[model samples]
Target chain A: MSVDVHLAFPPLARIGDPLERVSTPALILDLDAFDANVGAMAAMAKKAGVALRPHAKAHKSSAISQRQLEAGAVGICCQKLTEVYPFVRAGIRNVHISNEFVGADKVAMAIELARHITLSICVDHVQQVRDIGAAADAAGVTIAVLPEVDIGQGRCGVASEEQLAALADAIAAHPGLRFGGLQAYHGGIQHVAEWDQRRVAAARSADKAAAYVRFLEARGLPCPVVTGGGTGTVEFDAASGVFTELQPGSYIFLDGHYGSSEWLGGFRPRHGLFIASTVMSTAKPGMAVCDVGLKGVAVDSGLPRVHGAAAADLRYTAANDEHGILHLVDAQQPDRLGERLLLIPGHCDPTCNLHDQFVCVRDGVVEALWAIDARGLSQ
Target chain B: MSVDVHLAFPPLARIGDPLERVSTPALILDLDAFDANVGAMAAMAKKAGVALRPHAKAHKSSAISQRQLEAGAVGICCQKLTEVYPFVRAGIRNVHISNEFVGADKVAMAIELARHITLSICVDHVQQVRDIGAAADAAGVTIAVLPEVDIGQGRCGVASEEQLAALADAIAAHPGLRFGGLQAYHGGIQHVAEWDQRRVAAARSADKAAAYVRFLEARGLPCPVVTGGGTGTVEFDAASGVFTELQPGSYIFLDGHYGSSEWLGGFRPRHGLFIASTVMSTAKPGMAVCDVGLKGVAVDSGLPRVHGAAAADLRYTAANDEHGILHLVDAQQPDRLGERLLLIPGHCDPTCNLHDQFVCVRDGVVEALWAIDARGLSQ
Candidate 1:
């Protein structure tokens, strides 16, 4: 039987349609706020004299990446190897795999992509270096290798200078591998609530990275680039004089978690991303249920907040697979059925991964639909 | 510029490959366990004399739905209108949208799908009834309407007998709408830890549903089908004598959240679904980072558990965007880099949504790749 074309549903909104015409539970992007965020981050990085490599893991849209490039971003950083394909296909020249990976499949993918683009990847273990280095050598293509140092984030990175040197040496030993620099990213400090605490943490991370750089320099190893920092710590890292590059992903579409944090005066990104949801049910007295839930928005950080609503006015309390329970604090003003509400997702990265495309809107009119090309390219 | 084929990316695993050869952070299905679970649920429903209409929101795979149908399921239940497209395209004749939706797009979709297959939908509001009913009438197709009653889950469904009757009456007013039955699913009680408490909650829900049925019958309305129950409360709901059909979605792939619950005898479903993850980072002592994280698995319920490992031995303590922090309790048995582990996801539905396809494995080898066709069709 022929597959019905309707099964592969059309985009939620057309270009000329109004905001109300867009379907519910859609990932809506405000183009005005987005353009301002892109401009702000680009200008901040240029003034700071630090290369800005926005993490595409947040948006996963090649169109957004192209806009970032046009706004003067150096390159884009992806969290996975497979995630880099879309950007590479979209003509992004410089790409870095921010996380480490193992296995022959990853090595083959690295070699395949390195042939076409300026590819760089991180390594915490010597085995990972040897695996990719060998494949790169066989392919006769040079791949940039950055040894991720565990400055503070204890998840993925080399803990000691000895281990870092070994990984660097392994990369140097291979003919097709080049020592890129040190990756001193501390993901834990990105969401520190207090400004002072987050600044101190970023300073400490920079200090430790400086120490690693000194050790590598003393051993006659050139540390060309010291790339790190996130949306929370970008200001501190850019001013630290230790980090040569800033990798801030969430600044373009500030999520609820990032919005809750106190940012420096120069760089507070606007809330451009939102989940357009409809009040599907108003059954309970103080509760209203919306169509967006775990499937449409990511709740890993916390529950999403209603856009432009005060903390006391409305609160999203619970989320099921396909429903979000909204607690209406104002008893007199009840949410009507079919009433549209914009939800600012708690976390932007994984929330972008949950949707197929973004319904880009400008002045309450749908402007474009950017495909989340790497939505499920987690492998 | 032409889009590269590699940008689309291929499946993580191929048929006839060994399980270890499958790419990391892939959704893996143990076909043996899946067959057993499907057979067990089918046998129980047959013995209980209740129609088995498994929910497709959990799997979202037409291949699995075909298997469920072959195992004697009457039809399938979808959480959204868009989600039914794949199963319908695969020739599943019966479908029930077990949730409420609004908008002209949904009505158009309902009308289009009802033209080809037996389609049933739920509603707690008269507007929804009128919206979909008028469209169905104009299209000259009869769509079954099930007025969802608030059995206990306060998220959706009509609150009172008056509201339920009004919705049913509204459905009857349209020439193309038929009062199929009442939906009395209590989602909150599905995850209750204690079996006794869950049983009591299920019984209460059944009692409330029976009352609504009587009320409707006294008013000369036919309550033909009483469908509501999940994997956690299937046994209780089937034995309650009030529900004519059971809608258990997660039984085919018992997740870590459901596995932690206490189940009655004769109704324990084995964990048939898992995330095949490889340890990518072992930099920190007493800790290992796996490839599966928030993007690969759903952590809304809880963190995924290491399959076949004791709670004290290995624990998935934290989840980042693309990394799972595995806390090694057994000091001597640290997770090695490149080592593969099966992860039982915290919740199956959202976790399944995060993947593109299920790597079906049997006898430690990949048997097939089942596309998660309706994965992001949450509109």
Candidate 2:
């Protein structure tokens, strides 16, 4: 089966090959920009005196996670249970599932993973704690639990102090479970566009999380860690004085959506990720069709932006399953068939999950092929 | 590396197991509904005196294609070069690449595939014809070439008779190439919503294709085939008298986007595909979160709809990377924790690409596990 996969989707390029040798519709990673982004985030976290646990949900590559760890990241945060396997298999000692999950299969996976490494998971319900805790107890392993509190995202987190306290008590009641911290991630506020508005929103989220922390403290419960923040709010979150750790994923590969936002100051991310596509057809006047589309890149946010100097001449107007319609700004400057173009995806997380491997390039030459180990590990 | 993939994403359930045994966020295929859908489309094409060539880009499964072939499909259509690998490997004799592709790598793949099977591909430019024709000649293999004419889709097809003639002549110039037919697909007209509007759009597309066929006939060119149609326009195209073959993919797995359209009906398709997700979080008052999200389903068409009776009471409001937020219509009827819900995806093609395999179920029991062999074969 593995051989079948490799044969069907062979490596687009060999190491040290020229950029033109790489196949179209392949994920391209600029190593210099990536390293700079990684180092910048690490430096910002160190200066702010907070732990940097870069989320693996963005890149989904164990090799990229290793690089993050080497640059002084404390650990990594995965949004799903199965996403942790690749990192753990690569000898990572710490992992935190930063989302809530329930079911026998999930509980079994949690218990199995806890035996090999320091495993932590988030919960917003008492039943979730019991589900994993009982399985862990039966397996004779301890697991860390973090109760997630809603900080404005309003998706999957506890809404009230009563619910939060009950979840903490539920964790304390289990011998195999320990109260790790609080997850107060507000995913909605991450793309607020305006600098002032985003800053204010991040502050409100931080205040709400601080209030939850105070409630826990007043009830004589230990709140050892307070983890939150993302790429858009990392600067304010690191200085918020409430969050003990930062979980920023997309900072390493700033996409077109993030690029739309105004960045005023510290730790500006670079565009390290791109989808290299080819102009397959120029059949219509002033319009060219590229090979990358919904299957190659995620279009949930919007259509991708043509990168480099061509951005002034070409615009990606629409996407079908396997065809991206590119309209020329100047009809005279038509895109030639087989000409390559780098596309900056509208979203980074889901876009990374669409590919099997990333063609890491340095100085316009292929450097490595990093497998997206957890590409389809949504289970 | 393949073992790593299997370990990280194990089979959700074994054959003959209860549906509850399947893991959350799994692609589910109702075998009964799927079989009915296959039979319906095949019967429709047969009654209309048109050959059926079901597109494999929707399901990406060799097993599904095999079933289509058994149901009387003349051949299968793949939208990409790499996507043809699984069907070819599964002993499929006839395969047509229904989209135009360019590049030396693509030419090489085409020549390699033509050497083993009766391969046919679409082209809109003389350069694309020369590229594949030269490669096929060197390999001493005869390949069928179809020139795609723009029938209002404005994506990847020749817009003028001169360009179409050029492509046809270019194919005839090479001993290894044969002018098989004309391709006139209007993908944009597939989802016109209203019955009359869609009918008119389909008629216009048919008329345009008929004009192209007449043009070819006037020049003494034998247009043996004229293929183009999707699930939404299949009913009209089968009786249009212009197309000799029909290519409808999503009819086997009618999604929310296609379900929203009005069908006056020659053949009504059933919803055979679903994403089985568990309500993992119910901490928020009137809302719940499921495991299937942006990574599990495609949202470019729209958000998925909750399947079955609960759909009237629960709405899938939004999708995060790993969570689908569901809002309850009646606050009293909250979704229970660990409860499974079926989700009809917004789109079928990209949604199928997100999963590795489908859990085929019949009467609430798993019947088989069919691999999505060409899931990410966008190359």
Top DockQ: which candidate number? 1
Best candidate (score: lDDT): 2
How would you encode candidate 1's per-residue C-alpha lDDT over A36-118 as one tens digit per residue?
99999899889989999999999999999999999999899998888999888887888988889999898888888887788
lDDT (tens digit, per residue) of candidate 2 on B107-189: 88887777777889999988999889888888898999999999998888998889988998899899999999988799999
lDDT values for all models = 0.89, 0.91
* Candidate 1 structure quality by residue, lDDT tens digits, B269-297: 99899999999989888888899999999
For model 2, residues A260-354, the per-residue Cα lDDT tens digits are 99898689899999999999999888988999999999988888999998788889999999999999877787447888999999999999999
Q: For model 1, what TM-score does chain A reach? A: 0.96
Q: What TM-score does candidate 2 reach?
A: 0.97
Considering summed lDDT, which 10 consecutive residues are worst modelled in model 2 chain B?
Answer: B1-10
How far in Å is the alpha carbon of B37 misplaced in model 1?
0.8
